[model samples]
Target: MNINNAYVIAKKEFGFNIKNHWFLLSSVIFCFLNFIIIYFGEIISGDYSQTDIRSLSLSIIHLQMYLIPLFSFILSYDAILSERESGVLDLILSYRVTLLEVMFGKLLGNCIVFTISFLLGFLPVFLYLYFLGIKFLVLFKFVLVSIWLSFIFNSFALYVSNSSKDRTFVILLSIFIWLFFIFVYDIIFTFFVVLFYGSISNYFLNFLLFFNPAEMFRLISIFYFIPNDITDLFGINVSSFNNFYVCLSMFIWVVFVFFSFLFFYFEKK
Candidate 1:
């Protein structure tokens, strides 16, 4: 609980993750993706050009919903376990720091690295769009939420890393979580709706979507930015999703994440 000790751990973590080759490689890839989104739009979302900020922003959100979570997982999946395996985590724990501080430091450090890496790629494209009189606040806004996404999977990765005895298991679990939350979860949710068509209310279905952070993030990116006519970032007129529920459900999801993180650190060494 000592802020100084936590800052020390955070600073150490920051230094280590800063030189990560994966972060640099991913940043370059991110820049390339943004370039495609800006100029050669038809390649991805078929928005066809940069003038359509809404569609382009939607494309950006979808892209982040995929890439950011994977990047986060890869970056933090071994945050504690590798250190534990190598005895570094025990060394850090011997310091006058609480386990909570250590975990917080690791989470903060990785989150900062991911955000900076994202911004390094995002800012140039944002400036170009700004000159074209197109609003890029959508990108800016999601960059803020990107930290939350990073934290979610970073914590998930860290938790899975801690809860087991095998690093291979940790890696496999990370991949499964990334795939399930991003791709399979939504498909299964839709199948459930289809299987129970008239029985399932759209409101409940709408609430169900946000249970997965990726979907919650996708909707959160749009709900405050776009007009009332649009429900989701895709503009797929699925149903009238409530803004109030969006806010409520996101709060619940975050709380769920918080307790999930808390229980792991408390129960583990």
Candidate 2:
């Protein structure tokens, strides 16, 4: 893999995506939508005064987890697949560059775009909070988690792009996976837990909860929102345990997904 070739490819992708008006427009629209939703919800619920800055920050973080994944899917789900479908993959492969270079360059390029769009969308919210005299550390933590969430989703999208040959199938599959991660998995997990009731052990239930990314995100958000001891009936520090386990699981998933992509790419090649 030539570093020069990878850089060239990365530059081309970055330029092409940055100059695309539709992408820019859509990002702006979505940012506005997020602000509107948050602002209006605060008004209608009449909870703005009651809400702590940390809680508001968590709300923004939760929204980013939902939005960034969709944005990443859009940016990357078709990256390699579209190139392959358009008959450019063969031409690219004909070059002296290795497949791994091509994949890494493409992934890096898409990640750059993902990061830019996410920060652009999130900046206004951060600014608003700052003007409202919110703590800087809270905002910084939200930004950190937002970036990690983007990486997780972008890696998944890259894996899908590399593995699939059909663009439509890639898009549909990405959407299905997104829905499953964000919503359906929790419902299914809860249903089974309810059905089993007391038959399920606490250890088993704890392990089961770690499987879904959304649940992990929620737990982390809860911890960030209410960091201190809010105890349960069992007198266990639920928030402390939730924070520790959720962060551990998220770290594991990031490593697992990244290696999974590399393995699939090498195997397919």
Total clashing residue pairs per candidate?
A: 0, 0
lDDT of 1 by residue, 141-194 (tens): 666777677778887777777767698988899999999999999789767876
On the 0 to 100 scale, the lDDT of residue 9 in model 1 is 78
Model 2 over residues 26-134: C-alpha lDDT tens digits?
Answer: 4686589778767876886688765455545555656766787888788878778878888887899898776677767876777777667767766787788777786
Segments in model 1 whose C-alpha atoms lie over 4 Å from true places: 42-54, 131-136, 224-229, 232-247
**Model 1 alpha-carbon miss at residue 68, Å:** 0.6
Residue 8 in candidate 2 has what lDDT? Answer: 76
Give TM-scores for every candidate, taking all chains together and pairing residue i with residue i.
0.85, 0.83
User: Which ten residues in a row are the worst by lDDT in model 2?
Assistant: 229-238
Pairs that collide, model 2: none
Whole-model lDDT, candidate 1? Answer: 0.75
